[model samples]
Target chain A: MPTTLRDEAAIAGIGQTPYSKNSGVSELALACQAVRGAIADAGIEPREVDGLVTFLMDSSDEVEVARSVGLGDLSLLSRVAYGGGAAVPIVQQAAMAVATGVCRHVVVYRALNGRSGQRMGQGVSGDIITSDLIHWSWYMPFGMLTPASWVAMAATRYMHEYGDCADALAQVAVVTRNHAQNNPAAAFYGKPLSLEEYYNSRWICEPLRLFDCCQETDGGCALLITSPERARDLQQRPAVIRGVSQASFDGQEQMTSFYRPDMHRLPEMERAGETAYAQSGLGPADMDAAILYDAFTPEVLMQLEAFGFCGPGEGADFVRDGALAAGGRLPTNTHGGLLSEAYIHGVNGVAEAVRLIRGVSHNQPERCEHVLVSSGVGVPTGALILGRDNG
Target chain B: MLTPEQKQDLETQIRAFVGRPTGPPSVGRDLVNEPMIRQWCDAIGDANPVYLDPEAAARSVHGGIVAPPMMLQAWILEGWSMHRGHGEPRDEQQRLHKILTDAGYTGVLGTDTEQTFTRYLRPGDQVSAETVIADISEEKATGVGVGYFITTRTTFCDAKGIELGTMNFRVLKFIPKEAPQSAAANADAADAQPQKPTRIKPPLSHDNAWWWRAVAEGTLLPLQRCAQCQKLRHPPRPMCDDCGATQWDHIAASGRGALHSYTVIHHPRFPGYEFPILAALVDLPEGCRIVSNVVDCEPGALRIGMALQAFIHEDEDGFKLPLFRPAEPA
Candidate 1:
């Protein structure tokens, strides 16, 4: 809860396996590979890891992952759900554990063959949510079915109140892709599109387009975390966990939030940003670069608005200056993000954030003081502010 | 043998029993019941904003996420918890039904159910359903009893208690000793067939909304419900052997029910019905089952879970239509 916690903890090492459209390995194998890579990157032995963390959406168990990665023992192992919202929060968990003496060194990894392996976004059907669908049977039978279809209603209404056209959403896809076009690791590398292309794209539900959604990728990313004193001795420049927070707002639904009073306000994101800032003792202007989650391009725009980079609808204008690339104000998704990068839920975004702070990113930004990262938007969200370990 | 007309008549009576009311509701709930709502949400998996976000719910035209329909499934299990199994842990259908109804609850025999979403439920929204007495009947049974059987009817009403859908169920009461001679035999035989449930699919079983195509006449859709929770569940399991039995029964339902409940949508989000189409819950008597959809009738008279007859009617788009018509008053 104290601001000191953020400034005191840092990323000791970061590692990522090759991004892929598909893989021959199991999810656990991918997880172990990423974990070992991170440990080796940190110059730490597997036995040194006292803690572990992963995404709840993953199929691999912690014990199984630890065993596969050759980790001797662990004092703590945890997982955070809420889809992409687990991104930064997992590191925060590792940091919290190390800070509290519950563990020494922590390894956090996310293995997602999210694209060819398990396409969470192909949309679901025929499943009975005794609670959600039973409740949904009351509503959905009336018409709400797919996740995008449900969220589109909210997007349409948001555009209505803000007086912005669907063009406002086009800025995000084009911008993130522009960054991805040059990053070889990106699935969409060299696959750039015009704003007109984004607008003319087919509708999944209503305002959303083909490019507006993220790529379903099969990849894994991992990080090694330790206390500031310990991290400085590691192999790579430690990206300190400057701040992290998770939030859920009142009246939040899974995806269908048709009853919201205001579409512009992502109260969950706002709450997370407020908590992160209060704990980190840093404001938005202090951030040097960010690796925002690009699950849906519009989500990034809304996140910019929530993180206080810009006010309300000004997110479109804030990034319109092309300042999100190298040598610009705060380059984002320099590793291509979920849109271009292999979708590992939000874990890949965390990996990119570390690269930004270490100046090792494929598309490294010019300035690097602080790096910002976020989890999934819409549902419950999480965020973190990472900085170089000064100690 | 039941003529198509006889089956229709029996279905009509079942609807009347479930849909008719006695007086005001014994209990009504609003969205503010967070503790209760939280219990319900965690029980299911409705993490959506339509159920949690206040600002979002307020923005939603419907106010908040309405409770999922299958939520009633919990009563079946909880009822057992109160009783701790039929005096000895044996699965007893009679005992399970009795305790549930004794707790001011009644369930429809769901031969088949389908839901289409135009809107989603949010948190802090007021949702209420009223259980009413719609009609009653008596029949001499040859399969395990020789006595009077009763059908109870009910409907879901909103905060204003607007009719949501009608639920009709058949409760068989025997002369106490004429039990089905082959109870264990029936259980074994039921297992031999192990009919797959038409309601649930793989991976995510609890959130199965649009899982099945419309059924053909002579087609049987297995009654589905959750494993953890029992009541009128959709994804079926013996632990939740919906009617409270370790023994799963594949009852070959007559599949003909009168329109016990009906509604005409002014919108398309409801799934099958577009352009002011009709939808309602029908009561099937043989299996004592119930299901919903548009039926052949004037929209105006399709009052409160009314008893209209049903048959399989699939649209050209490959959606089987659960068509129904009003039956003569019981």
Candidate 2:
């Protein structure tokens, strides 16, 4: 609320397990492994971790993960929902806890056997996520089953309003895949996607080809958040939390907010960006890079518009000419995003945002100032702004 | 668990009935008429003029008022007799189900359906349906229980024996697990048997069950209107976001709307549905939008602001839902 969390807390460390199709372990195990890695990376003992936060969709309970990873008594245990939309909100929760003296070190994490286990792309037929069931039922019966299909409804309308966007959508996928080529941790590190291949790829849902959908990956990601004072004494250069915001706007549904007056753009994500920018006293011009979610290629275009990187319906032009690549304007998803990187929901994207701020990303831009990071669109989403620790 | 030998024997017995008819063809209790069509249109919130106005119907491709193709099965469904069990099971399909029931698989779940409409029916058409056992599967383990998938094919025809449509329905007969032993169940579970997917039933909550029940009654499409601000809201929420009024009442929709947005789904196919589904969001006259399937039109025909009408379709499992189609030209 009034820059309360702005620069109050910092991401002291980031950790992740290898991105894979199958982790060959339970989600709880994957979560604990990432948590331990984050603690060790922060140069702190497990006993120093007094707060734990994760997505409500996470299979690991806070107590179980803390107990497994040998963490001390937890003062804050929080969970956020709406799938990947909780990516930044989990950080916000940790920042709030640290700012309020509720805890010293808060670990925000996300871990899932998304591919080997419950594939998110397979739709919500048997998934008993109660919050999604009511809204999902309205579409699931008619075969609007998967997340791709849900987003395609908006993509189709976007295309209807703004001629053909195949070229623009291809730019998002191709640019991220190009960035992935430099990062060994990315799922598509060696497999560079060409514009030709993207055009040739089969349709997952019309207007969303196979290359457009994010990988259903199995992995874990975690970040350590603490006060700026403690972060300065840590082992790594901290990525200060300049601003973080999460918002659920009016006429919001899980992924099927078709009832909105305008279904093409994501109002929720726009609200998130406005609040985050206001908190940090920054605008689109201040952001040197970004880590926008690429769960589907069309959402990347919509998010570019939502965050005011470009005018409405002008995202197609904004993403052309390697604009999202390492050397171009607004170098985005430098670690390949969810599209080319492992889909650890969108937590991995947050880690990439921090890497840009720390000037350590493999595809780091020449000038890394304020970096904008977004979670899933088409839902109640969130945004974050991180900056280099000038202190 | 049955031995492989015993399982083969059961499969052989079930396979014998595949070609046999379920029973004598069942006829509709009444001829196709406008009143039934109007009731279906209102119940589902469809306002297609062709189904209601004679002038519009006469000028349209139908050349006369025609019933929604989705209502094909509704015409021949035995009303009170089937529900009350007064109509005894005396068919080959019934005997096959009895055999399965004699075994441990007593629980039944309707999985999916595939319907093909040959043509639309006009008023005065007497519809009849004849069903046959189409196929039966081997015992397989599913998320719910170990079961067998049974498929039945039904052909609907007019009084003159002209083919109207065909529906292939699938259901799973399984042994209901007394308790959920997810760990043990997880170890041997084959992909959760959406091998034949059913329409995921809507969760009936305290605030929205009344709306669903009204749709189930097959009469009106009720919208929740806030008594305080006189605002209408869909999805039946408890409090009005506009006025924060918990006090609300219902108003029947005129079944008219316009297509606001849509998608043609092609991949990650699910069971119990046809491919290239035309899923749409319809902007109703009441200022609320509804998510439903756009029927009776091709993907290329869909536009952002095309007029639409809603209809109520009751599947074989008696799950009533609202679907939309292109409105007849005014």
TM-score of each: 0.56, 0.74
Q: Which digits, one per residue and each the tens of the lDDT, describe model 2 over residues B1-330?
A: 567897777778888888788889999998998999999898988899989999999999989899988889989877775544312345777677666655656556788999999988999999999998888887787866798898999999999999999999998877765432354332222222322345667666667678778888874467899999999888778888888999999888988998887888888766567778888878888888877888889988998889999889887778888888889999
Candidate 1 lDDT over residue span A1-391, tens digit each: 4435666577877777788878778888888888899999989899899898988877889899888878988899899876777887898788888888888899888887776676777554445344544534433442334455445545544554555545656766777777787788788887887977877776554456777777677778898888878888877888888788878887575654333446556888888888889888899999988778777766777788888988887776776776576667778888777877778888878888888888888887667888888888777778888887666
lDDT of 2: 0.86
Chain B TM-score, one value per candidate, order as shown: 0.30, 0.52
DockQ of each candidate, alpha-carbon based:
0.03, 0.38
For model 1 the local lDDT of residue A342 reads 73
What are the per-residue Cα lDDT tens digits for candidate 2 across A7-96?
Answer: 899999888998899999999989988999889988999999999999999999999998899998999999998899999999999999
Residue A131 in candidate 2 has what lDDT? 48
Candidate 2: lDDT of A80? 96
Chain A TM-score compared with the true chain A, each model in order:
0.94, 0.98
